[model samples]
Target: MQTQVRVRGARRWIMFGAIGFGALFLVVGLILAGVSVSFLANAERARGTVVALEWRNDHNGVSRKNRENDEPVAYPVVEFTSADGTQRSFRSSTGSNPPSYEEGERVEVLYRADSPEDARIKGFASLWLLPLIFGGIGLGIAGVGTVVALATRGRS
Candidate 1:
């Protein structure tokens, strides 16, 4: 009888914790989605060329543990001609170990007329990936909590 009571208590705590964390993640995802939408709303599109690849090393604690396994990430430097006939160059915020683009590759860029320096690469991964990931995780976790609560309700 006592063990059953303890199990019920543990399940209750687990359910509440999952629900709480899930809600937090959901809110963060919503906020990120909102920011992305706002950025796209004021952005103008232009064609850009990859001028260079900036290689950077991940010198964090985890990477330090495995020196042989560590590889430098390549961030592309893109140059574009703005609407006002001014040439601007900016480095992409996204990077990959294998280098996603060649030096001469042409890609789309999204920027505001007021501040072309703050432009970003116009792609689904650059803009929407984070929100989708967070929202998906949040929903999954919340669903787990709901399932647990429902399955154990009758036992208690």
Candidate 2:
């Protein structure tokens, strides 16, 4: 029947699309993991001072807090001197409600020699978070796609 043929064709296309997306996600995850490893290997360490806490409001509307004991997220502003003797200031990527760093506190900083502006607080959370998050999502998506492709192939 024409309808049966069309359904088969549609299932074939779905399988192909799922496989393609799975491959794409796997490749992206691998690349991100590689970059994260490279950064860890080559980063230089320096002493930095926390200059301030930058507050951020995540709520789209109304001034009321969204959750119990909710407070504005605060990211640290840090200043450090590079090996080249240039002073650089950067905001930390990590934020917390109670604030992890106090102003005028000294902390370790990790940065690339070629690009000092690309720096962060030297810690496990700052270093490993992005790669772990991206890789996890990518692997989850790819796994789902793989299951869909396999199930469709078995039916065929």
Scored by CA lDDT, what does every candidate get? 0.89, 0.83
Per-residue lDDT of 78-105 in model 1, one digit per residue for the tens?
9999999999999988888899888999
Q: Candidate 1, after superposition: displacement of residue 78 in Å?
A: 0.7
Candidate 1: Cα lDDT at 83: 97
- Span of 10 residues, lowest total lDDT, candidate 1: 58-67
TM-score of each: 0.87, 0.72
TM-score of candidate 2 relative to the true fold: 0.72
Number of the top-ranking candidate, with TM-score as the measure: 1
Find the number of clashing residue pairs for candidate 2. 0
* Clashing residue pairs for model 2: none
- Candidate 2: which stretches are off by over 4 Å? 58-72, 96-100
Q: Write the per-residue lDDT of candidate 2 for residues 1-156, one digit (tens) a residue.
A: 999999889877876776677667667767877876888799988999999999996565755755554568899999999999999999998888788889999999989999999998987667776667766776776677678877877777
| Global CA lDDT computed for model 2 | 0.83
